[model samples]
Target: MPNQRYTNQRNTEAPMQSSIENLSRAIFTVNRHAKTAPDPKFLYTLKRQALEKLLAEGKATKKGLHFSKNPKNSRQQSDVLVSAGEYFFHLPPTKEDFSELPHLGELNDHYRNPKANMSLSVAKTLLQQYANYYPTEDKKQPGKKTYQKPIFKRLGESY
Candidate 1:
């Protein structure tokens, strides 16, 4: 009976460990592709939702904040650093994050995330499942077009 209990405990731990690893890999793949994706809104949303779920489950930790490399409108910005399963990622900081987490200054260019071999589609699917994210289709009315007046330039007039 003692031996059976020990084996059962080990069995449960193994799957949990592997699941975390798989999730981390999926996150890495999603993050990588999101950087260059033309329509990255959905990808970024998926990553953020997954990280939030992991944090809520006590599977991930907030490390600190780092200055964003690409600030919008030339204004300064920062992101929250999160650690999970030997992987690190940055999430958009909330108002509380500015007060609660210490700023880590600039991002480390030398450090890189571990290489993951998962496909983009697989990664998206895995994250969607884990994050419980269901994308809703945009409900635009068919054949609806807004008309714009055409601008005509006067011939040879600098006015």
Candidate 2:
């Protein structure tokens, strides 16, 4: 009779144990499969609009510079002006180039943290560097300002 009562108790607990296991599995699955929400700080659309507006104003013709794409890296979103038929310039230097401009700490920091604002002078300096390095056809030599690496295609492919 005692064994029969123990068996009855065990049978009664089976459903509760099963329910607890199911609940644990559901929670584990939810947590394991959960996705992280994307950060909204990056201006995905504004960058393009800003570029278009800047180009439409003919800033390239007057300032002697324009935004294109970095030849060294074709997949970059921000455009660096084309010069001597090469995209040697990057608006905010890529991770590889960031270390080179240690003096421009504020600008580099701003690049790393997009939310942070950068000084106008630093921004101008970057643009000026590109302008000085890659002048227009009238000002630059045909062979000057070549890409460090062998570019597979002709320049202006992305711009």
Candidate 3:
């Protein structure tokens, strides 16, 4: 019975060693595949060395990796304020991000001469939408349609 117990222990030890060897080979294969560059250096070896150095420095403990926390941006400045009355919108200067609408006829320019160029009909539509949704704080509630003149009218047009 003692001899049988000794044989059983040997049998279990052989399989355990083979299992460990298989696990190590699998780890090496994964480490090789994780390499992004075609360089001869193994990332696993580099990571192991770095971890050993950190451990020696007492910075890394059994709990987890530790490092100094970075300071937050407390003095971050706000963007430029551009408003139309109480409400305003942000439009990026990049042209490619937005699609250009087809040309609508020129509208009457009260400040300038008789008429001025109107290339952006979408802007007019957006402004109209905003005006419709948010007329004013005291005047009208949001989502109520309001009668407003088109952004562009004919040279002698009246609406």
Candidate 4:
């Protein structure tokens, strides 16, 4: 049988060895995470490293690479959390050791800068959506089908 590797080291390392750890420490004002309280950096680093391998879709875990009814392995496991827009992901009992993983949308703002992403057409469409949601009586009912105006209109106009 193959030898089972085991110890305080195996596919994992000290927190100081990872950029994620360093990043975590910086993101959180705690100064020291594992030794301190819960920090947002703990979330970022955990997700930054485990995002690819930690997805379970319908379930949550306090362990890395965890699922079903399997046993826990703290030596190579750590809890983590991730947030994408309104969505939230979590990994309890977080640890740090990231050598593989890439940030999502890291360069999305490059070609599509803040100003570039905001096009006149898109602005018009968004405005129209909210505009239609307003409650108003038709000034001149064309044929009883009825149309409405923005009775409570937004105070400002976009260019």
Best by TM-score: 1
Sort the candidates on lDDT, descending order: 1, 4, 3, 2
Give the per-residue lDDT digits (tens) of candidate 3, residues 1-159: 556553343332232222222322332332344355464243344333333333354533222111212223754222211122122211111232223322222222332212222222322222233223222346444786898987987899996
* CA lDDT scores, all candidates in order: 0.86, 0.29, 0.30, 0.32
Candidate 3 weakest ten by summed lDDT: 80-89
**For residues 1-159, could you state the per-residue lDDT of candidate 4 as single tens digits?**
479776663332322222332222222222123234353443334333433332333122222222212236634332333432222333343234132322231112233111122232332233223223222354555666656765664679553
Identify the leading candidate in terms of lDDT.
1
Error of 2 at 11 (Å): 74
Residue-by-residue lDDT tens digits, candidate 2, 1-159:
556553343333222221222322322222222223152122222222333333444432111222332344665233333111111112332453333333321112222211213233332233333223222345444666766976586676763
TM-score-based ranking: 1, 2, 3, 4
In model 2, which range of ten residues has the least summed lDDT? 81-90
| All candidates: CA RMSD (Å) | 11.5, 26.3, 32.6, 25.1
- Model 1 Cα lDDT, one tens digit per residue, 43-135: 889999999999999999999999999999999999999998989999999999899999999999999888887778777878888898967
Clashing pairs in 3: 107-153
lDDT of 3: 0.30
State how far residue 121 of model 2 sits from its true place (Å).
Answer: 21
Clashing pairs in 1: none
What TM-score against the true fold does each predicted structure earn?
0.75, 0.19, 0.17, 0.14
- Clash list (residue pairs), candidate 4: 79-91, 79-92, 79-93, 79-94, 80-91
